[model samples]
Target chain A: MTYCVALKLDRGLVMMSDTRTNAGLDNISTFRKMHVWEKPGERVLTLMTAGNLATTQAVISILDERMKAPEEREPSIFAAPSMFQVARIVADTLREVIGRQADSGQKADAAFNATVLLGGQIAGGPVRLFLIYPEGNFIEASDDTPFFQIGETKYGRPILVRAFERTMSFEAAVKLLVVSFDSTIKANLSVGMPLDVALYEEGSLSLGTPWRMEANDAYYRTISEGWGDALKQAFDRLPDMELPTSG
Target chain B: MTYCVALKLDRGLVMMSDTRTNAGLDNISTFRKMHVWEKPGERVLTLMTAGNLATTQAVISILDERMKAPEEREPSIFAAPSMFQVARIVADTLREVIGRQADSGQKADAAFNATVLLGGQIAGGPVRLFLIYPEGNFIEASDDTPFFQIGETKYGRPILVRAFERTMSFEAAVKLLVVSFDSTIKANLSVGMPLDVALYEEGSLSLGTPWRMEANDAYYRTISEGWGDALKQAFDRLPDMELPTSG
Candidate 1:
């Protein structure tokens, strides 16, 4: 169980993901879900994964290895002609990983399935964001639908739907993601702390250092507690309903 | 495809249910999901249904018949001595309906399952709320869990978790319910307008005339729009995060 979200804003892309992975309630572990492959001045690519840990790790490892050994593996993550091609490569990697799991005698089921959020840019292409499915298919975010959420998405969606703006500053975008993730972490045990975040400013063609937010981060605490107080006050501001007097 | 929620507060019980039902995305219809049987000054029982419409309607019909013909039908709903017994009767009725469908040679599936939320006072018994499953079992709300939401519950849950209070006034409770329902309606096509609501004040031993809120209802509009603005204001109040300087 994981919660990963990416927004394709007018300025660039903002992505965040929880680090918790669990085989069962008692068997929980923390693993980085956000993976980055940057080419400095040429391109920047970010991937956030959710689903079977083995499948995601395998997909990431394959992508990483392909980037380093482009002579051996064609269409490397670093060599994708555009963001769409990158999404296609990531989707194929996910399906390839799941296929390997099935070939290893595991029954055909969703056990090896993985979903990935891919967002980045190349030197010539415009910034793009996509949600890649386990089946090697993907959907790009556009003006009407500017964000994608995977895994435990519902708990945090209302806030995003109400607050997200394509023109908002990176600071506000990060703050919104924090509030969204905070709501999810509080509601679901599967999505825990120490969130991994990446900010890609359009046209920069470079990825900045990713930020990690821990459970005890003062800013996270402020937003968590402040949001609660704000919500209560907001509830109070709604006009009261007139109760029916008779049956 | 419905959304019904009930809250057990210090004052009494506040329940709300959307009126939408659907056989498929193309075959949507409106049907009342909230039902009430009140013996003025003696007892009040409010039930909200979600899931298979046939199963729910059958269960409601059986309960309605048993109440009117107590001499012919043993363990009539009105004859139940306690709220727990009332829940038992409702749960059993639900299973009976599903069992009948199974006996008709239909493949056993969730197609015939229905979940119910029941809440009210039975004179001497304290005001109680319950969530009855299709398998003839139910769980009562406690101090820790003072609310029950069935069908398309996730989108509306965060607000309830953060804002609900046991001692909140009926005005606040109803306002909270409206916000919750509004969120669900926006997120799910299966849950629509013309919501049915019931208010049971403890010691009254009677249910008031259930209110019907339409899509064009003025107060509903006020809250729906007000909530969006309030949330935006709340998000703006949260302190901004300092972006990482380098990779």
Candidate 2:
């Protein structure tokens, strides 16, 4: 299991993904789930994947190879005219990989399914974020839903729903995502640290080098411990239930 | 879908369950998920269920009938020697009902599975709680794992993990549970009000009348709105992330 979240704030997009990948309880490994493509001031695209490791890696590898050899692969993400086109390419690739696995007599096609979170800007286009499903369909985040989370999402979702705002700074948004990720990591062993994070400033048309937050990272440690304490305090502040003595 | 949680605190047991029952998104009705059996000064047992409504209802009906006709049913929960025996009786009934459904040509046995949370005290026995599976196996809650939640559990679990303490008062535990349920109800439409709650104090050997928190209940509304504000304040209190501007 993986936990990847992308927030579309007014300032920009704040995205985070866990590094743990496991085939089973005993077969766990660290793998980067965030993939980014950039052509400086022209276009910037970030993709975070969750689901079967083989299928996601295949989708990423195909996209990466296309970027490296654009002449051979006609419809590379780099040359896509808009963010919508980039999403289409990613969705199609995901479906193609899973479809191949099923076509080869794999009894469970669902076993090969993968979900992707794609967010970035392409030159003149407005910043956009999309959640691409395992079925090759995708939906864009709007004002009503300004964030998308894939993999081990439920434990971390309530906090996001409660705290997120459109006008939050990039720094505040990243902090919020960290807290969300911490809650998920504590409840589920499948989503572990270190984390990979990417920040894209609106209209910059370029993404910074993604940050790697190791387990012992000072800030992550502070937020993880601090959030637990804050939660306890908040819980204590709630009005207590008064029991009736009769029964 | 449903959300039922039972905690074994030092004072006794605190349990809460939602009233939503649905065959599909469009077919929803309210049903009580919490059931209690008491012999006043002798024993008090409470059961909360989740999963297929048919299987759970069938299991509950059989248990209720056996208790009503103890002579014909030799192993009724009322005559059980200990909480362990009561758990076994409930687990066996659950397994029996599911097995019968599968035997009657139900293609998807998993669809008929039901899980139960049983907690109570019998005269000379210690206050105990058990999580009974559809397979007729059950595990008791202990100092280490003092609570059990069944159905739509993930969204509401983080706060419980952070706030639950064995020594907390029954009022505090119920307050914490309301917060948890509020988070779940906000995130999922399948689990909704009103809620059913039961409190069992050790040595009392009996449970008071269960509380029904209706959707319009003033206290429930206060906690629901207050929690959202408290969570936002908590999120703002966390240290903001510092980003490298050079990137």
- DockQ per candidate: 0.70, 0.72
DockQ of candidate 2 against the true complex: 0.72
TM-score for chain B of all predictions: 0.98, 0.98
Q: State the DockQ, from 0 to 1, for candidate 1.
A: 0.70
Top model number, DockQ: 2
Number of the top lDDT candidate: 2
Candidate 2 Cα outliers beyond 4 Å, as residue runs: none
TM-score of model 2 (CA atoms): 0.98
Instruction: Report model 1's TM-score to 2 decimal places.
Output: 0.97
Which residue pairs in candidate 1 collide?
Answer: A209-B247
Tens digits of per-residue lDDT, candidate 1, B29-74, equal 9999999998998899999999999899999999998888978846
Candidate 2 per-residue C-alpha lDDT over B1-247 given as tens digits, one digit per residue, 9 for 90 to 100 = 9999999998899999999999889999999999999999999999999999999999999999998997894589999999999999999999999999999986999999999999999999899999999999999998999999999999999999999999999888889999999999999999999999999899998789898999999888888998988888888898898886533
